[model samples]
Target: MADDKKVLDDGELVLVKDYVEEIITDLKYSTEDNFTLKVIYNYSDAYLRYGTVKKLKKAQEIFKKKGYRIKIWDAYRTVEAQRFMWEIYPDDDFVADPNIGFSNHNRGTAVDVTLVDEAGNELKMPTGFDDFEAVMNYDPEDEKNKERTENASMLNEIMTSCGFRRSTTEWWHFNDTDKYPVVEGFNSII
Candidate 1:
């Protein structure tokens, strides 16, 4: 991980694993298993702005005390990647339009995450990653949705308290607002 330690400290974009230990990364865009059914990202690593990394480090410390950790699904997307994703999903509520406003992820200030137990298994949430249903909203009121909602509520409480904004539709998405840079090419920063 020497190269990781060297190249990953870019002030504009740094891999989350550099500061957040044991943070599992599931780069959805780097595989065919995603909504696109094709690889989007050329590489697989959760990269965010350095400032975001420091904020996440704080969040991880808090989660660690609670016997939980963050598992990341995706982070640091290029506009080209977003365009390809839009071609497949095309839902503005979920996929941001590359032609218009930039995605928070493109800014290296956003992350898609879920809480995991000490054993490293993700806690049960309202829906799995990429689930766009209304029930996937952070908290649902139905008794059947209690565990899921409570789990999401817990994530919301932790991330928000740590300075990350929760997404209204995707329970797993969060943004570190103060350090947003909004970019078009993921490699441009490198």
Candidate 2:
């Protein structure tokens, strides 16, 4: 690490876009297309904790070998943004309670992501980002979801292989809490 001042200034978060090659980003909160139907973030950059970025880079290396790239939807949300999100969608199962504490995203240890092909097209999963419905809940035994399940499984394998764990509620979400401690508050990705 550099100096404490630098680390604190940067919020101990690295811009994953700067470290990873060909990483596609589509931060929904930065635009009006998200669940809130309003622009929340002032910018579109994505960020993760220093340790989380290392895991994400390793996962991306594995994905590239298999002809896929990572597509990030959200990462390192600010506390203000989290509060706005919770006010819009107060479901504990999906959105974390800002009053209680920051969620994985707010901690800068979680990422909402899916895989993309060599052509930069997103791979189909159970559902889109922030769906927050039963469809987002994945089950391996469901015959109807074989295709979706397989895609989700592949993503889980890639992420887990690099020290990340998939969220049971959202396939696109992953955390690196076991290997790296989650940092609460905000990383100033906005």
Candidate 3:
């Protein structure tokens, strides 16, 4: 994690762009319109970095085993992008404060991903990414959203068992604990 004062203003390289490019091409998937790989950012928002190329590949492998694929929403966000999130939800604790330091994406340790069918449509989950509520927690019996909750729990379990941690608020978000240290302020090259 980057210190509050160590965030980069110009952004640094995180994942090698070729890594993302090669993976996308190899998978025969198309990038979403708003995100780098054409997935939606911030739950259908803009395109940016919230994941690294390598992470996406790993996610793809995991999803593939389950007969699905990973659909990335966002990856490698810039400081300005984080500022945009702050404007929309100032009280948000999920998004890192730009002033405090770089984000996980800046470090290339985090990812916002969803399970999708062969056609690339999203599956049911507790809530959409960045939903900002307990509704997204991996509870199996939250009546208000039971089906989604169970599914979210399943995803969380799978991801964590594979060394990824859920972001608490976003069912689709995950990160590799080991990769956290060197990722601060690392730039995205979508």
TM-score versus the correct structure, for each prediction: 0.88, 0.85, 0.63
C-alpha RMSD for every candidate = 3.1, 4.0, 8.8
Report every candidate's CA lDDT: 0.80, 0.79, 0.52
Residue runs of model 3 more than 4 Å from their true location after superposition:
1-56, 133-140, 180-190
Q: Which stretches of candidate 1 lie over 4 Å from their true place?
A: 1-11, 134-139, 188-190
Model 1, CA-based lDDT = 0.80
Clash totals in order = 0, 0, 18
Ten residues in a row with the worst lDDT in model 3?
Answer: 22-31
Best by lDDT: 1
What are the clashing pairs of model 1? none
Query: 1-190 in candidate 1: lDDT tens per residue?
Result: 3243455443567767766766788888789877677999787878888878877878888888999988888888887888888888888989898888878888888899998998888898988888776444444767888888888888899889888999877888998867655764456334
Better of 2 and 3 by lDDT: 2
lDDT of 2 by residue, 1-190 (tens): 2332443332367777766756888888899987789887776888887778877888888889999999999987777888898898898878889897677887778899999899888887888787766554556687987888798889998899898888868888898754334455543543
Question: Ranking by TM-score, best first?
Answer: 1, 2, 3
